[model samples]
Target: MNLVENLVVFAHGKESGPWGTKITHLAETARGRGFEVMSPDYSHTHDPRERVAQLLALAPTAKRLVLVGSSMGGYVSAQACATLKPQALFLMAPALYFTGWDEEPQGVPALCSVVHGWHDDIVPMERGLRFAKSNHATLHVLNSDHGLNDQLAALALLFGDFLDQVKTEIL
Candidate 1:
C-alpha cells in the first residue's frame, strides 16, 4: 500500500488523548503497513457531535480511508461515516445507543470490525453486539473492561489483522 494513498484516522475515547497508548500502538501498526495515520485531539469538548464535526473537518482525503475509534470516539467515527464514506471502520467499546446521542449510524462500511470488552462497565457489550449484527460487522468480544488497557497486545493483533483485511479488499 502506498503511504500517500492509504490513510488511517484514529479517534480516541472521551478521556483519552490523540496519542494515548492504544492510538500510539495502532498508529505504529498502521505506519508499518505503509499507511499514513492521524489522530485528532477532541479533548476540548465532551459533546459527541462536536467531535464528529471536528473529525469531518480535519480528516484529509485519501484513496483508501480507514476510521478507528474507541468509546465515544467510536460513535464519532461511525457518525462521520455518512460523509467520509471510509473504506473500512474499526471500533473498540463504542458508546452507541446512548440516551443523549440521537443520531445512531444508519449505515456502515462493508469492511467494518468492532472489538468490545465483555466486562465493559461503561458501554454494554450488547450494544456492540447489536451494532455489529445489524451492520454485519466482524465483532470480537474480549475478556476485558471498558479501557481494555490490559488487552493491548490482543488489540494490536486484531487491529493489524483488520488493516490487512482492508488492504486485501482494496487491492
Candidate 2:
C-alpha cells in the first residue's frame, strides 16, 4: 500500500503538547508505515473553533491530509475537517456534544470515519453516531473505553485500512 504523505493527530482532555504518548505512538506507527505526522496540543473540549484552526494550520498540503483524533480531539477534528476536505480521517471515541462544546460542525468531509466505543465513559457512543450520520461519513463502532488505548492493534489496523481505501482515490 502507498504510505500517507501527511498524517495529523489531535489530543483530548488536556494540553498534551505534541509529545503525548498516544499521539507519539500513533505518529511513530504512521512514520514506520512511511508518513509525516503532525501532533498538536489542544486543551480539553473547550474552544473547539480555535482548536480546529490549530489542527488545520499544521497541514502543509491541504487536501492530502489524514486526520486522527480521540475523544474531545475527535470532536475537534470533526468540527474542523467538516470543510477542509482532507484525504481521510479516523476518529476514536469522538464526542460531538461536550459540557462546554459550543460549535456545531456543519459536516465532516466525505473522506471521514468516526470511530466509537460502545462503552466509552468520557464520550457516549451515540454522539459519534450522530456526527457520522450528519456528515454522511462512516462510523466504526468498538466495545472499548474512551481513549481506546487498549485496542491499539485494532485502532492501528483501522487507520491503515482507511489509508488503503483512500490511497490513489479521487477524494
Candidate 1 overall lDDT versus native: 0.90
Q: Score each candidate by Cα lDDT.
A: 0.90, 0.68
Candidate 2 vs. truth: CA RMSD? Answer: 3.9
- What are the candidates' C-alpha RMSDs? 2.0, 3.9
Across 48-84, the per-residue lDDT of candidate 1 in tens digits comes to 9999999989855688899999999999999999898
What is the C-alpha lDDT profile of model 2 across 62-121, one tens digit per residue? 336777777767766766665656667778777677767745676455778877777887
Give the TM-score (vs. native) of candidate 1.
Answer: 0.95
Q: TM-score of predicted model 2?
A: 0.80
Stretches of candidate 1 above 4 Å error? Answer: 1-3
In angstroms, give how far residue 142 of model 2 lies from its true place: 1.5
